[model samples]
Target: MRGAFSTNKTMGEAPEMFYVNGFAKVVPEVQPNHVNNVDDSSTWYEEIIDDDLKWSFKLNSVLHKAISEYQDIALLDTKRFGKALMLDGKMQSSEADEFIYHECLIHPSLLCHSNPKTVFIMGGGEGSAAREALKHKSMEKVVMCDIDKEVVDFCRKYLVANKEAFADKKLDLVINCAKAELEKRKEKFDIIVGDLADPLEDGPCYQLYTKSFYEKVVKPKLTENGIFVTQAGPAGIFSHKEVFTSIHNTIKQVFKYVVAYGTHVPSFADSWGWVMASDQPILIDAVEMDKRIEERIKGKLLYLDGAWFHSSTIMNKAVSKSLKNETHVYTEDNARFIPGHGIACRP
Candidate 1:
């Protein structure tokens, strides 16, 4: 399912329309009125997370821009975060702190498993998730599935940090809807990572976060002692409370044990939340976990270690109470995730 790259469209033009699999669709054009307009006076890219909260980065240059079938993709060279990737106006990853998000999202679950070999990554088109998974010497194969081929191609071309990952022969790139692809595949993995975008109401990822997707599509694909982990949402008590708790509670319904954790990602401007769930115990002794990580993972890690692993699992009282009180389960019928709005810090 490879998408053809078009350098034909010019800036400020109505976006071109293309057909995929018999359906006619128009690639979303970046409106001149949107943030990061790249006018003569401004070179700043702004990401509006909620109505009031937005983060702005000074752009060095525009690396690539595309309106894919799934979402609008932009790769920008920023003064602070280096090369940054954005999907539909949301910041996905940045060079300066990407290791924090990718390392936290990947290593925790992989280290929790006794021996994680085969890995399946969903929606991590940037290649960092697959890169981290391959860090383990025991990793035999990694399958990274993303819905939009253009995102993967763009990242591979402009994001130098993940270049080795894209070139790794052991990696298998699949461009398709992850849920549909996983359902058809007969092979199961030791670690299943959901490195998807925030599930907004009209977003492509809303269905992926639903209880039905986890129960019917994801669970059966895991090995007996396998672990499932995903990026939950912003961990601020005042922001995105329902999004975090709903993911936790929904996964709790399927797995015997579930734990929610948080870590500060500078580019995101908040302590981001992540959830790990497995029928088997996930909280291993800190000492033993450290030993396994040292022995298995070969490269220098940026943000995660044994002590951080134990501390990350421990949540504040307010967060714990919120999870305890949250009774809603996210199903396909009731899946409406509205991203937090309200200005936090002005650029």
Candidate 2:
């Protein structure tokens, strides 16, 4: 809830010097006579949430920083969240709460399907999505396609939790744009996951969220009983309409049964939304969902369980009404990008 660092001057005082830390470098906001007035306690990382708002945290330490072809990347350790990953100045994942995100993203759709033997993950460069998918005893093959090899390599080297999943025999990792990769393949998947970056106006990921891509490319590549799921951005009471409602409405255009759900992610500072769709009706109740979790999954899910999953689907009145009334169908020209997203792509 901290305000963004300011350089504006006071009425009679000298120019202000604000220092926001990045990759261990404490660059000072230098002005007349204020160049040397850097405060050591001001070493924090800040993310813009809106024109008038920002979020920041005190940095314990910074591990890495670099600019890749697709985006800028950083790794930092914090007292509150453990190790954290940053891309394009936006928080991607935090060690303390990442399990909540990864489990929720991969488990629901996979468990809903009767037998999900083959799975495809788009842009799970961190290997967390593949890790959760592989835990299902029914999985035979899991393909993870990410456009940026650098991100994948960085994750492989540093994300110690997913190392075993990356080395597993069933995983087929590919470095390519997900859309182009899916188009080239003749094989189909039982579950397809969009574990992608938020759709930013400057990001290349906006097209991947469009109706054209879903119907023309993604829908045709799924098996008859297949399910498609994607993270649908922020679902806070004041923020759900940015992408979540429109994403649900757009998918309803192509699928027979579609459901939008959400859960609070502490690190994200909002309730994150997800949309799941399939041709087959989802008939299982919470009790049945729990039974499947016992029989199918290898380890206990830290964040999601049958009861929690059921509750997540029951949206608040405001979001429910917005979803019902939404008319937007995502297209290249008409797409909506998250306003708070960091510039994650060149185009």
Candidate 3:
């Protein structure tokens, strides 16, 4: 499992330029570089890199107006770790694990409820969430809000995997700061999906992680019996292997019920985590969803299906037992804790 940011630097000579996480080094690399989106849809970084395994930070990409363009990949440096724009591989399409992540984010709220027609997406400019939201034949309107315009433009240009998902005429794509944009809209949504980063601080995403922010700014926007969902963090990095638990506990304080689920992403070290909360319980039948996915979109995928999807929800015995035996510490005052050492949200 990968760890969060610490003060240590891998290279002693460039202490301020890089951050170290054991052997995996994340160093600053972006400096006054202009990205020319190649082949209309995808872009490549002209800067030379000796190794492909290491992560590099784009210096010019400040927290607000930063973007990273790589071959088959792009990242918006939104202060924290940034948003990933995938063009190729299992991570790109709505197949397997990626499908599970996006489907779970959209479906449970819709299928579990008696009525769901309108949906709002916060920060899924790549169109995956918007695409999945449109899958429901009952859904009437789909609103998408993302801070960076570059992500939407890049997806429309190069990511063909999302062509079917975003082609819907009912989709309303809004390129604006999600927090501020959602504030102005008087209309509430039947389901609200937040695809933003999980960081409590570090980037523009800090506000989204706070309970005060959600209660005052986000919660009231939901329709009656409306369900709210979002991407939390990795279990290994946040709460044992159930990273969304921290967000789950936080949301439970605000909403009526909060539950978390997991998915294994190839790009992430210990897969990824998701948090879904509502005034009611969400009993997702992955088996049924799988049949629907197969009937709806007939394609080969990497991480999700009936079997894998069902297995993902089952807590790993090792991780579950470890967490139960150990005490994890977390507080609103000191939310940030060391990663990968059991649970740290309680301290």
Cα lDDT of model 3 by residue, 151-193, tens digit = 5776775456678767778898897888888899999988888
Runs of candidate 1 with Cα error greater than 4 angstroms are: 1-42, 340-347
For all predictions, the C-alpha RMSD in Å is 9.3, 4.7, 10.4
For each candidate, the alpha-carbon lDDT, in order, equals 0.82, 0.84, 0.57
| Candidate 2 per-residue lDDT over residues 10-98, each given as its tens digit | 45543343633332234444456553655743456666665676676667877777777777677777777887887766677889999
- Count of steric clashes across candidates, in order: 7, 0, 16
Summing lDDT over every window of 10 consecutive residues in candidate 1, give the lowest-scoring window: 338-347
Model 2 ranges off by over 4 Å: 1-42, 340-347
* lDDT minimum window of 10 residues, candidate 3: 42-51
**Model 1: number of backbone collisions:** 7
Best-fitting candidate, measured by lDDT?
2
lDDT of 1 by residue, 100-131 (tens): 99999999899989899999999999999999
Q: Write the number of the candidate with greater lDDT, choosing between 2 and 3.
A: 2
- Using alpha carbons, what is the TM-score of model 2? 0.89
